[model samples]
Target chain A: ETAVFQTPNYHVTQVGNEVSFNCKQTLGHDTMYWYKQDSKKLLKIMFSYNNKQLIVNETVPRRFSPQSSDKAHLNLRIKSVEPEDSAVYLCASSRTGTEVFFGKGTRLTVV
Target chain B: GQQVQQSPASLVLQEGENAELQCNFSSTATQLQWFYQSPGGSLVSLLSNPSGTKHTGRLTSTTVTKERRSSLHISSSQTTDSGTYLCAIAASGSWQLIFGSGTQLTVMP
Candidate 1:
């Protein structure tokens, strides 16, 4: 049972192109986060949104941006995609100071 | 900055054997969570124990906040339990979870 959902289970795009990944959570959690998992299986925090306000923005590349409409949806957009962007983008949700749940994740391949 | 470290980077066990994975953190943590990552790239949250001990099914998680350490015990291991186990910690007044590299477990029949 997945309360946190992500779109386009897999995506392949070319360099210099733009890509967007969509995420939604039915858990009614006030906090949402986007994490990047590299080929080495290292998970890195990218951005966190709480109650529709962007918070905890890590030092990632400028190409990455998070968009949200209300508290249930958070979307990630990347411009001029790079090979390094070819990894799994995981969307997660949680209540403040509580357990966090993750979605299946969207696999992005930059060709 | 908070850091989470997991020990015994990799482990192998026979079916029915119990396995224990350890986690240590550098700062005060108000929340702790364990996650399992399948080889297929899917992730599942196993348990979230900020302190003391908690159990669900065959998995048990124990966290010592003052000591900044946690341990995950998997009882009666099965081949289906083979995957990577991740430990994460969130410091007080913060919502970000600092994750460890994870411990890979292999269970043989």
Candidate 2:
């Protein structure tokens, strides 16, 4: 069973369109993270949220933003998506200094 | 710069064979975890070893904090074990995890 849930397992959208992916965790972890896996299978950390406060923000484009309504939920919104944005987005959460639980991931395809 | 590096970008093994994967980090890690991703893209936590050795079923993980390195050993590899193995480390005082480029394993019968 998965403790982290991501909706819209796969999404396909055209360029310049806005898209949003939702993620929720039932693990009661205080820290959550978003990572992007590119075509080369390299995972890159995009954002980290601790107790609903932004902690680590990588050098991601301004078009990408993380929205957290509560500690259990973190949603990703991409504005004017581009072709290069096509990749698998993973959501993970963990308690401070512990192993993280990850969602199955949302694969986004920009055409 | 990549903080974590995984050796042998890809590996192939026959059923019943043993496989070893390595992960080296650039800094001291407070938490180190090994994860397996199936071909379908689901992530499963295999082991978490900051230091010392830990085992689960056919999988064994050994971490040497002093050397900032870790290794995962799979005994009696099976066709079902064919997938990607990823190593992640959380630096001391950091809330985020740095992931190493996964090592893809292919087990054939």
Mind listing the fnat for each candidate? 0.71, 0.82
Candidate 1 off by > 4 Å: none
Off by over 4 Å in 2: none
The best candidate by TM-score is 1
lDDT of each: 0.93, 0.92
Instruction: Write out the backbone clash pairs for model 1.
Output: none
lDDT of 1 by residue, A1-111 (tens): 899999989999999999999999999999999999998898888999987668755578988999999789999999889998999999999998899999999999999
Full-model lDDT, candidate 1: 0.93
Against the true structure, whose DockQ is highest?
2
B1-109: candidate 2 lDDT, tens digit per residue: 4399998899999999999999999999999999999886778899989999999999999999999999999999999999999999988878688899999999999
What are the per-model C-alpha RMSD values against the true structure? Answer: 0.9, 1.1
The candidate 2 chain A region of ten consecutive residues with least summed lDDT is A50-59
